[model samples]
Target: MRRLQSPRRTYDWGSREEIPDFLGQPVDGERVAEVWLGTHALAPSLVDGPDGPRSLLEVSGELPFMLKILAADRPLSLQVHPDAELARAGFDAEEASGTPLDAPHRVFKDPHPKPEMVLALTTFDTLVGFRPTAEILRVLGALPTSLTQKLAERLRAEPGFAGIVALVEQLVTDPPTPQEVGDVVAACADGVQRRTDVKRAYLTALEVNEHHAGDVGVVISLLLNRLTLQPGEAAYLATGIIHAHLKGMCLEVMVSSDNVLRAGLTSKHLDPQGLVRCVSGGMSRLARVEPEQFGESTDVFSPGLREFALSMTQVSPAEPAGTPLPDQGRRIIVCTGGEVELVNEHDERLPLRRGSAVYADAADGTIRAHGTGEVGQAYTPTAEDRATPLTDLV
Candidate 1:
């Protein structure tokens, strides 16, 4: 069993305490954004060897999926990821154009569709997809701002998904002025004090304003569905789902690609055309995934995605059967909470604690668990996921 060493990433919007305390580390006020646990070329996790610490890419090659612990204190960008077809075309075009992979303007990191799922470890707030047309009009009608009235008029004239897409196009092409943005925020704040049925919508706008005061995304919030995932609840986004995560911590799992098309509320490179391209998929509903109980102690969270699924198990002194994890593909187990001993198919046992993890090759077969506390197992498509182009599979 190879004990994997994961990398912790820091970003400005990250929480100061969530990740540190989760790993039992003393809080130092460092903003820990994400803990990457995968074999992706960029920020690959490592494992120790007699020679030295080796990249997981060298040890296990590239896994189909990546797992991460995300802790956010502020709103992230309103963004979308390209589908498998778009990812390949976009990446190839960028590559042919002689754009460096590490360049700030580079978009696609890998030729894989980035369909992601976030399982909340804390109360998580997010703006996902588009709200219903009727709902959007009702919320906008309450606001007396010119921006809101114009948006409401357009939505009423067209209605439904077409109106939503048109509104997105208008916002991206002709972004709201700072004064117009401020007016919408002020209207939403005032509405929050008076409106009851539409209070949640007003609050969502205000919440985005609290983080990004003058960004055009504050008005864009009116277009999305505000969703809150309680602890242990999960949300999944297939390719082309537009979203922005606001506040709280989560366990994020996705294809081993870092491709993102951001439009606003971020300091990262902006790509309005890329965002609109991704959003043109025409999705109407928010995607929510429920965990399926597997065996006695394990819960499998797979939205039937071909790339990867996550299995979480808890074992204590009370029940001695431990966790029997399924093999979806290449297996990597991380002890997110408490202490546990992992027994691989070869009968090798590795003891893992709060922040420790292990990786197993396809030849290793199934890995079982023992001891106490919680463990998360990642299941990808054996060894084929990374080696093959996702375009062929999807």
Candidate 2:
């Protein structure tokens, strides 16, 4: 097993304190948003070897997937990703146009679709997708006059996803007047005073407006799904699903891709056209991922994917598995609490602590982890397992 170095992605929406405090470090007073632990070219994680530091991408060469820990302080952008074909076409177009890969305005970064799973480490909140039409109507109807008038007309028409698509399209196509924007903000501000049930989303709308100014995400947030996940709870977003992480920290793992089509809640580049094309305009409900309990300390969360699988094991000093793990795929074991001794196939022990993660090669069969700590493992499948469809696995 080799210790791996994870990369941190700092964006403007990041809180300067939350993540640092979580790791038991002095809040660096600097905005620390996301920590990337996979093999996305932008900032692929590094693993230490006797010679030097090697990127995870170079190490996991032909391997099919990547794993990560995503800790967010404030909120991420309202965005969606394209399916593989669209991703490939967009990437090729950007390259052909001579657009720098690192350019802020560049949209497609790679040709891979990103289907992600995020499990809350705290009470995490987000706007996932559209809520039911009646629920949305109730939330919008409760708003103060001018703002309600603007949204009420269209929402009352019950246009479903198409109506929502049109409303968002119109707002983005013909930018709202400065006075009109002020009216919406004022309405949200007034609604905040009323303290309605949708107060959380209303507050988010105001913050989003201030962040992106006139971006259409503020209005979109109103019509999307509002979700809150307790610790150990998880949510899954498939290809073309529109969503945004609102607040608090979480552990996130996904297919290896960094392409995001932004509508708002960010100072970064906004890909309105791409975002519009990517959104599904359907009601996406909360993802229910029940942990599969095995013995007392181990619980597995497999979202029925060929690319990867994750497991969360709660270790008590009294209960220790004396044997080796069943996984044969490339595995990354991360310890979130206490310390653990990982014994290799040859019986070599690797000591790991909180926040420490190690990469174990696929061929390293039946490894043993015996100690008192909370650990999670991520891995890809073998040929035989890969041949089996995900539906059957579930």
Candidate 3:
């Protein structure tokens, strides 16, 4: 096991102080959004052990997945991710077709699907999946003018996810004129002025659109489920589930890929067609995750994913030397909230604390944990792919 250092990603929507303060570190007031702990090329973690900061890629020879503490001060872009096949195809096509990898408009970054899970470190708000037709219709009924009438008519005539898909297809492929857009905005603004409940949805819809002026994803928000996750709660995002993290901090674990196919709401690449192609075409409902309590010190946060599993544990000062590491696949552990003393097989204790992580290879076997405060682990399982190892982590 080796202690590692994570890389922080500074984005515009990030908080200027949240992450800095969370890690008990000082910053120059730069907006820091995410601190990535895995190897995903864009920001690969380096070994920060007794030696120095050595890139994980150079040391381990493979990037499992990048872990992050995502701090969102504003809404993230309305984005979709490609499944494995599509991701591979798109990345290869871009490469073979002579598109620069770092180009501003590049969409697919790698040939792997991005399935992610977010565990709230604070109260996290997000918009995920599509709202049912009836719910959307009710929201639209409160809007002003013939716009509401037209939408209501559509919901009445053609409801369900299919109908929403049709509407989205139309808006994306054959968008309305600029005049039409301006008119809709005006009507929404008017509705808000009239103290209509629809105004809240409309304003949210409009805010998301600011990132993607012409994308249909702007209006799509009006038809999606809005959710707020308290600290320790989690939400899993599969490929093509349109989602935008609105605010708050969270621990995010995802597959080892960066193949985002965006429809709008970002300065990054916009691949509307690719997004539509990869869309799961199902309504998204609140699937809030509750951690499975493990004794007194451990709570496991496991999203049903094949590639990765995360466990959150709070070690009290009185707890004894904990269980040994699993005799399974590769395991990566990170301590974000407090200090931990890890003992190897031969009883060599290594001290670790916040912002510190370690990679335990399959060959090394299980290590014992004896310390105080919170720690999380992300690892690949050796057993069947269908079963999540969060239940099995001792």
State every prediction's TM-score relative to the real structure.
Answer: 0.93, 0.89, 0.87
In candidate 1, how many Å is residue 69 off?
Answer: 1.0
Q: How much lDDT does candidate 3 score?
A: 0.72
Q: Candidate 3 lDDT, tens digit per residue, 1-394?
A: 7777777888888999998887768978899998887778777888765566788877677756667889998788777787888888888998998887678788877788998888888898888787777778877776654654676788788898778776666666666655566566666667667777552677776666565464556666677777778887777787878777888999898898777776655666676777778878467633555565546666666566657767777766575667444334566787767777877776667777776778766555666777776777777633443343332100
The per-model lDDT (C-alpha) reads 0.81, 0.72, 0.72
> Given candidate 2, what's the lDDT at residue 140?
75
By summed lDDT, the worst window of 10 consecutive residues in model 2 runs over 385-394
User: Which prediction has the highest lDDT against the true structure?
Assistant: 1
* Residue pair clashes in candidate 1: 329-380, 329-382
For model 1, the superposed segments whose C-alpha errors exceed 4 Å read 197-199, 281-283, 381-394
Model 3 CA deviation exceeding 4 Å by range: 49-51, 174-203, 206-217, 323-328, 382-394
Q: How far off is residue 126 in model 1, in Å?
A: 1.1
Residue 205, model 1, lDDT = 80
At residue 74, give the lDDT of candidate 1.
93
Point out the higher-scoring one by TM-score: 1 or 2. 1
Candidate 3 or 1, higher TM-score: 1
For TM-score, the strongest prediction is 1
